[model samples]
Target: MSIESPRTAIVGLGITEMGKVFGRSAVDFAVEAITSAVADAGLDLSEVDGLYVNPGIKNDTDMRLQSTLGMRDTRVLATVQGFGSSAGQMVQYASMAIEAGMADVVVCVYADAPLQEGKRAGAAYPGQARAMVGVGSLPFAAGLKAAPERYAVAARRHMHAYGTTSEQLGAVAVAAREWAVMNPHAQMREPMTLEDHQSSRMIADPLRLLDCCLVSNGAVAVVVTSAERAATLRQPPVHVWGWGQAHPGYVNRRGSEFGLVTGAAQSGPAALKMAGVSVDEIDVREIYDCFTYTTLVTLEDYGFCAKGEGGEFVASGAIAPGGSHPTNTGGGELSSYYMWGMTPLSEAIIQARGQAGERQVDRHDLVMVSGNGGVLDFHSTLILSAHPKGR
Candidate 1:
């Protein structure tokens, strides 16, 4: 099924306080976010009949949330298990359900409290050891590697092919911090210069400590309903113009066709095509910034610039606040508290609605949001607009 026209819209958004320690369970945060979203939409919980959640925490299933929240009318329940890449998928599924008449009001949510449990966030995955090697199966070597090392391999390729520099990568980190300084909920608000980014300790070669996203504790929720219904809500409706998802398979291991993972190359065009808008029309961008290189590669793949030109493009400060194309005004995952990619999505919605306070941009009509998951294995994109379809 294709969404040629904007039929569903995001009517409400809510986020829990972000910090090192939330001192609560994932469900508690999810409930809090959902309650805020429902109230923000000027609707009661009883009116919600659908739920879409990213199952980050163990045993955090849709049924568990439904039972806990007493959402008796929930007719559609789906758990997108895309890890950091699941945020856009959650919104996509909710919009699909609402468009299909399976539900009227669908609430999409994500939550985690890794710090409070004394556990390192994103460290639970046991790579490669669980994979069954066979013909056409991913090699055992693929399983032996983790995210930082895998992304480093790609970064090295970009440097070799395009003469990209660590300073160019540092530009992304600095820009993220520049925006974070204005975000009260941001975890790292200290002024960060390209020099500071370069000085940070190296986690993986070519990828410094400042290049990575924060391990944060937080939750986010968004309410999706028909555009007609959303028009009657309390807040301005952010129309879902288009969305697309792509899985490019594992690109870190040996004998891969692409060598460098570029799933956004496929997903971005699909979304833009569906939205019937060119890249030039996008006023704001919230690309996934799991690392600095992630943003660089995505920019090229998304047709923002020519291939191998991302380094120079970002170095021009075009993505920084007040630049021609403002990106991640909410600080993104790099400087802001990382609730996976939900932070970026929330920022996109805020921009679309003209609700972003200090970081608000002038042209708030069209916004592009992207998400990446599992070592660049999966990618998703969404185009949100301030106006409804055919307006």
Candidate 2:
């Protein structure tokens, strides 16, 4: 009735090869991960009566996992696309369904192949669309073309306002690379330095190539069951302590640099409140790092730092392993394969499970994983714990 009162728990987790599971179709990747995760949970495939699959933009198909993965029949199915936010939606859906007695075991799976790598869709822009009535740039580039000046302007403004420097931003790249070096599954394990980040080609103003994430083919999955059932599983359950999604419904058609910070400010508080925890209570974090600026804005909006002090907070190396909040220990999307931020979800589960190996932290009870979508206009925050809500 109330989305399973205390919370749901993740009993099984699985992640594919981080870099290039090339030659394999996206369906194969999804099936493999689903199979492994189900096995890890010590459950038969038949027990997976619920399935949530978030296909990539290239996946023009249904949420039908039965045919691809040999699933018998799923009582619950959800197929949606929110990029980074898809998994969060699936988790929320799974929680609600279980509470309503729709299904017992739910598996949220995401897999994407670089199938559409070279093929860019040339549909009419939103402004030019016949069905919808939009203004300005026909179809907005999410501030890409028109407000091209704004991204740089905002980063420059953030720097001038907070005394942040380019070197500080590069530090994030350096630290992320350092962690990637320890991750055998990471795509970019090669060590990078501040000098390297500074000299890389610039994609957008104030954002270098190294500051952006990589694109690769991979899949990740999670098995969610009741906390009561999780207690009997092989591994300790990673409880879903709190969850919330805040869609400000603000389309950044105006091309303002303020969207990242402002949008996050809207969603962060709502999530923390639901968990009944403060930012200080989180021991680990896996914020979406599609770009270096995303993490900076998130820290400020999430109250980890003052409004304009994100650069300093990141520069202090406080986010590295053994720091105040060791974030994205699997190197994140910035340093690892960008599986639509799904890998970070797996990393959070690993951190909460105390299975992060070298990057593992002490007192790692709770982890906060935030996903940013549609220019930060859509936010999904999840609080994962080492144990279920009630003792």
Candidate 3:
């Protein structure tokens, strides 16, 4: 049975370079991409009706990104601090607004100048700031360190419980690097071996340096509106089928287990149900890869594989290009530019649009992208297709 299509579409997308970004401010990069996106969609600046920014660690009101981009006139303006995971939520909001006649067009954008110096250099929004509160201080108390501790224990437990190996975990880095070799924008394009992965210095007990995602500077933006209006736009439109967010409510050392199984696992089925699709029905995936452990945990949570089988599943190379179900073909955060996993969200849209260039999939009809934020405290998932299937 052919599913009926919905009335929302992603009409445009834009991305900044992914690297050290020594000089350009994050908001500046975002404006560059968004401007390109508006032109690409054949829409004038006056057409935009809403603005949503990620407001990452390097964000500041001084940049006045909304006004600078000439989107301040939009009827709705929103600032969210949840990193890449906020993509789905913003899209959902835009969908709702379009459905209710609140706005005709919405653009979601995120950028961070973490590498840029000044008072804003280290000024992440308060929630993200709190997550890293202890890093630069006396004893290194940031959640970056704390998250690894929790994952080290989880990895150890998974190793003991499922016989997963360090080599198996390293395979993720290896496979991602392999795909990175094809992505011109990826930062760590050079290949590495499992031995290289295992031999790399350890940040946490089980996490080698290679197992972590690089911190780079970049911005990504996407434009959304009613599917009826999108059909008249310059570019093809990809529809949103389903969307959801889940929070696991785990935060500190004492709540390790709760945190491990938080948002990703719990909310995945709900999202799939809303989309009226199963895991096997998804042709492509863009799971967040802030860390190897994150990918490992999210795969299981999202029902891609049986619990505790993520290591083996990833080792099968299913996530690489030309696999049964490719994921993060733009190299993901592990190899691609990182705006705290925001570009992956945009890349997912590109894949659904069938414009992935070198990394395009073979006849992908459905795609899913999951974003994890706040030590896994928040999870947001989006289901997209070339044509919507009645949400």
TM-score of each: 0.92, 0.88, 0.88
Error of 3 at 74 (Å): 1.8
Best-fitting candidate, measured by lDDT?
A: 1
- Candidate 3 local lDDT, 355-380, one digit each (tens): 87787888678888888876677788
Q: Lowest lDDT 10-mer window, candidate 3?
A: 120-129
lDDT of 2 by residue, 1-391 (tens): 3443456788898788755455787787888888888988888888898999988645733477766766676789878677777777788788777767889999999887763334421211111223334575444445444222334555666777678778887877787788778777788888888999999987667877777777667688899988889999888799888787776665446655454455567666777777778989988888888767777778788888888888888889988765776777878888977777576688888889998787777877988888876555567878889976753
Question: Which segments of model 1 are wrong by more than 4 Å?
Answer: 57-62, 117-145, 250-261
Please give the CA lDDT of all the candidate structures. 0.83, 0.75, 0.74
Error of 1 at 138 (Å): 10
- Candidate 3 segments whose C-alpha is farther than 4 A from its true place: 1-6, 61-64, 116-154, 251-256
Candidate 1: worst 10 consecutive residues by lDDT?
A: 122-131
